[model samples]
Target: MFCTCLCLVLAVSGGVATTTAPSLADKHNALGFRVFAHLASADRNLVFSPHGLSAVLSMAQLGAAGTTDEAMKRVMGFSLRERGASRQHRRMRRQLRAEEALRTAGAVAVERTMSVEKAYRRALSRAFGSHPLQVDFGRPERAAEVLNAWVADHTAGAVPELLAPGSLSDETRLVLLDALHFRGLWKVPFDPRLTHRGLFRGANGSATPVAMMTLTGRFNYGEFSTAGGEDYDVVELPYRGDTLSMFLASPFEADTPLSALAADLSGRGTPEWTSRLGSVRRQLSVPRFAVDSELRLKTALTDAGLANIFNVATADFSRIAAHERLCVSDVLQTVKFEVDERGTEGAAATAAITYSRMAVEELTLDGPFLFFVQHKPTGAILFMGQFNHPT
Candidate 1:
């Protein structure tokens, strides 16, 4: 179940055209960074989809009124009041759907007892590209099964069980879910023969052996410093289509906390990092890792200054339904992301090579670092996380 409020926004904003608003992308980036900062805790493997969270929350903002709406806008960094903002969101959603490497799905499961307004349903249908589902939350067991099944089906079995049994109850008025499954092959696949177990320094001063995928190729690279004067490196690894790429950043000094880099990225948009990058030949060694994370966004959202939406009484959803007092009960997001030596079947022949004479600079993520799976054209961040320890 995706955020029902987000669904409402989608429905309301579906008609907005993409070309009409360029700031929409900026709004997406700002909101993505905000969510990342809130969800990213120091010293652990963290993974979540900023786009998924923001997309759903945008919907919620559309149906929100009074202070609830204000809180969402502040946290999300985008307001429905902006001219053509709704159209821009709708266009962005369509663009995401068109990407081959990314699979994103959102849904709102409303309790059968509640009466949904027809206008709300119409807007939801437009935003999600599907109609809302009615389920009997009175039977928590059955509700869990149904919602979990929907998540599994949408994510292509990557996330089998998103909502555990008894996660829902008779009192559950709404359930919002956003599931993202991404498997993108690199444009230049890492040589499998070069992969070997290497020691990864953990955040807490421990080291563990991990499978590291290595490749030497021309990549967009840059060197930047944090506000505190710490140096770091940024590298871009393009996926098969070039439309999606993973930007990896880590501090040069081993003892530097990954949090510093994360804070910088959140404060300064990714475009700054990308702008500093230019094509350079280097040897990159990233750990072969997979992270499946389940995030309850209530705390993160609240911390990001969107507190009133969760309040039972203070929250308002008058735009969605007239008489029923509706407030967001839970906003959940599940993300499954994996990085490996996989790319297009015959991409080896098309791989670009430059400057074989220079010694390849090694960019090994031997410790904690931040990574973002981003859409190149629009600069929308599909997923972002910290690889503190990849087991």
Candidate 2:
């Protein structure tokens, strides 16, 4: 009678993790960039939560069996079946929950025909702080309302509608939903007065007017060459909490496509940039934009070689429910991200003074660029996308 909703929200303030495992974090970032590449576009703005999607899928993997489990592990880069994987996940979730800036909540709703496993519920509780609830999926409209309400409540209204009417039906056996809302303020706020309409060079070689934010300050900056030997620039903008930051990258040549940069990102991941970044004073210009993306990941997952879980005949979720021949009917993720002049509260009061006498290097994102929101210490990519045209 119940439809399940797995909701996750990551809000970065000004704190960083000190205990994150490098190897584990690398695997996470690698998987995140791979997902971004699968969803990449050169002409459109894109944003999605890799961490959110990973969390939901990982939770589902707890109940998987045989090749279904193997395929997930192969694509996700980590296996829940591995020794101490669940404990490590539990520790990581606890650390995230301890941060005042990060908010996460997950729920599993069960139908009467399916029986929820105690061990699976316990794992969910320990790893995601999730609780189980019963809802009537037979009444699809009512199930939709319940799940949507839960998402809205957990995300503090950032995501109001996760499921549209008829997204669920009597035939629906399982639904996995994840939502992440992040509104991070810059460490040093951009002067609102300096935000003016500037021409953004489009991927098609056309230009459009956009509100560009400008600031001159010290930031983590680096320049690197892609596998194709093309040069590009990367700049890190730390949110109020130093723990989370957004890294922006753009090619040096105007004619160079953003896809090239995306390919490099997916191939090498963030360590390539993070290892090279150094504190530098620069005049940074970034567009003020908001992106909302909704994705049904079945296609993306399948394309990434995770097709077995979606196949009802071959699928095995005996760990969660042995009663019904349940397969993942739908896996959905929604994300809302906004960047503006304001950062976390008290950032202005605590903003550091950068007194530089030399000419500052300018880094402007007036064209298509790729970005990733990262958990600093752990190097886990929470979100990754391309900003081609502001939405």
Candidate 3:
């Protein structure tokens, strides 16, 4: 089926005039960076994009995008508060409070900015048109071609021919397509020759052999013991100015029933810990796999207090010309990740920016995984989540 062409109508009427360039906050940029980072790790075989989300927020702040100085403060404040709301409910509450404060003070002007972002997204849609997912035994080969083409096109061919369109179904179209895609390589590559198998403890306390990629280099890192009955390790992988981290934790060997540790770790709060680095070289192994899943991010985002966007009746995006109604149509994110001895590499692309790269090697995690994407300059948790399974 042909996708709709959500093109931009440049023809303008005299009443509503559009502004040239509006001020934008570094905070929004930083926040966008972090969100993209975490999605990159979740899977290495698909594209994880963050355009739609970033555009909406940026657009809302167009005219009154806070000054860089003020933006930095707000950005920092968000990060500090995030440390406090480790749980979903608390996190949502915290964001709502911040957004309300910005609105109450008449400081954050994002409406105009959002308008521009929306138009840009529409242009992207038309430039690289996409087809809805469809599957049928009779057209299995064609289905694979369709899926592979979308993935390659979105990722700019970095992750070539990754998905088998044949695996999709007409019902797949029903699933929300919101996705975040990233692609990059490690600052330090692991020796592919040194790769070896090591034991990885599963959620059920069973041990299995996993291919671990190893590396030896000075890395920014943190350490801590969680009240959740686990010892934690935080390693930072810095990019051109952005940095993302992986937090690995597991029940202290002496801790009681392993299941009990899992329960404790699930609670949310500031991830209590310490930071440091040392001269260390070790063998590491990780599974080579890709994850492709569709999420109804609308619910999660709405549950996080962004109901106005989903509820067209309440959405306040009137700044885009005289149009009185605008709400998020849908949020589609797809992420692909892969890791081996040479180093970790993956990509996360969304319909928003089209594509991004996040690659790292010489990476290893021997415990529970908790990762966060942060604007290296501002410690904002654009996105945060934990992975307990190998998808």
Candidate 2 lDDT score relative to the true structure: 0.66
For each candidate in turn, the TM-score is 0.85, 0.86, 0.49
Candidate 1 regions exceeding 4 Å error are: 1-22, 343-360
lDDT of 1 by residue, 55-125 (tens): 66765666678888878777777775456665666677678768776666677777777776777676666
lDDT at position 368, candidate 1: 82
lDDT of 3 by residue, 33-113 (tens): 344333323212222222334433332322111242134234322321132222432333233224311110001111221
Strongest candidate by lDDT: 1
User: All models: lDDT?
Assistant: 0.67, 0.66, 0.34
Alpha carbon deviation, residue 150, candidate 2 (Å) = 0.9
Better of 2 and 3 by TM-score: 2
Instruction: List clash counts for every candidate, in order.
Output: 11, 15, 65
* Model 3: worst 10 consecutive residues (lDDT sum): 1-10
